[model samples]
Target: GRKGDEFAYSHVVARAFDTDHHQLRISSARLHDALQGAVAAMSEPMVSHDAVAFYLLSEEVSRHVKVVQSGQGADEVFAGYHWYPPLAGVDGDDAGATLDAYAGAFFDRAHGGVCDLLAPEWRLDHDASRALVAEHLSRPGAGTAVDRALRLDTQVMLVDDPVKRVDNMTMAWGLEARVPFLDHELVELAAACPPELKLASGGKGVLKEAARRIIPAEVIDRPKGYFPVPALSHLQGAELDLVADALHDPAAKERGLFAAGAVEALLRAPNDALTPLGGNTCWQLGLLELWLQAQGVR
Candidate 1:
């Protein structure tokens, strides 16, 4: 956690505004104990480390305030992801090329790679992930490759992923979280702006420029910060055993969601096998079984 700039920038912004600011730090032991509760609150199998941090943070925030404003949709609405910049100037008329570009950047693994990890019965007859993205990209309202990418992310992925994560975690703690960036009027205006504008200054240039008027320049110019749980990155000691136990459990064996060879390979070198997006393969597989078991599903 000491390696992260999140705390530093947060302190700078907090002091600049001169609002009543408090800090909450969590230890590995506390995070481990809170893991199941975080997973349970999500009520779905998402492997992002952000969920646990939000869940734990909401627990603290609820004690201070009943409602909080979260900067969740700003990235999607303003095109703040790495993929957005690359999609600029691509031929939107070429459906195949557009889909290839978007999927190449967004999907963690190709459908073929995904099928390799599943047992035969669990494998799908088609590339469902590709099909979904293709349909979203082909929609009429978006004019360019970047627009299509932003549309898909803001309308589809953002709603189901990060937005849901914030909602579930805050609601679990009896706190209400409001997202102003997602307001229909603001989103419509942002959507109408040229894709190149949103893609400038690395990404979300418009938002960053507007922020400069209010916040310090150092924060506006700093590299983006991500929430990382170092303990989970390369599993060791009790953390490794926690994942090993879940995959080895009789329930996991009965479910047969994953092929034995793939599971065994990941277990043998848990830290080495990573997805295209660099997610830990061992944790991804273990998380599914862990979630199913938590939900009491057969």
Candidate 2:
């Protein structure tokens, strides 16, 4: 315990973490209410409501501490996300083609499959989105696939999603969130390490080994995790009614924010009760309505 405590105090003591289990549930209890408006306010629809809701919920507890540390940049810099592995594109060795394969996987995975339910005109083409990724890939940076994935994420996702969400939500409640993993000196050093060393036999192998020396092997040996969330449970009662009203409302359907028939099809499926698209699409459309109503768009 001394060695573990000593190592943590010396190395990871930037700020204390908030880990009160009961407080966590109470904080996130209103996720549905928050997202109903927050989602509508976003410029893009693809941002994950589940993730953002938790980020906002964390801020609720983080308010007590005033300042808290976050493991924000670790995955982006260390190739920690399972999706960071590289794949071969149709045109082997062609940099642009290679990037297409890389960016395509990201788009398909992160964008949620709800595009199929969009009113034809609302579907995302990603010509514009692809261009953004293509531009990032073409930039001068690390050459390996894993390295490129890290490089691309550092420039794009690191700040856009993780860092931005934390900052926005926490600051809304006067909480300050610090990211030690994004240290300039550490990032510089991490970039120079061989790509294989980063994603070697396992993703984040180097980071995990360094952690192994100080922390128990069992603690650092676990598989990657997406924070567990009870999305279906959170949608029960008035929350479910909100989604139903948003999806089945004849007036809202006339405004053309969603394909009502398609969405209702999802709501009606007995086997698909817990489907991801069912929740994601409804949340997006519901939020859009809240935002529109707030701005007098309707």
RMSD of each: 1.5, 6.5
Candidate that scores best on TM-score: 1
Root mean square deviation (Cα) for candidate 1: 1.5
Q: After superposition, which runs of candidate 1 have C-alpha atoms over 4 Å from their true positions?
A: 1-5
Q: What is the TM-score of each candidate against the true structure?
A: 0.96, 0.73
Q: lDDT of candidate 1?
A: 0.84
Top candidate by lDDT:
1
Cα shift from native, residue 120, model 1 (Å): 1.2
Candidate 2 TM-score over all chains jointly: 0.73
- lDDT for model 2 comes to 0.60
Worst 10 residues of 2 by lDDT: 1-10
How do the residues 1-298 of candidate 1 rate in per-residue lDDT, one tens digit apiece? 2252267887998999997888888887888888788778775887886788889899999998999999999889999888787677689877788988887887898778888999999999899888988988998977788888888998789999999989998998999999999999999999998887887787888888888889899887887666777666677777678888988999999989997699888888999977776688788888788788888888
How many pairs in model 1 have backbone atoms within 3 A of each other, for residues 3 or more apart or on separate chains, i.e. clashes?
A: 0
Candidate 2: segments with Cα more than 4 A from true spot: 1-23, 26-46, 52-60, 88-93, 109-115, 123-126, 232-236, 248-251, 270-279, 287-298
- Whole-model lDDT per candidate: 0.84, 0.60
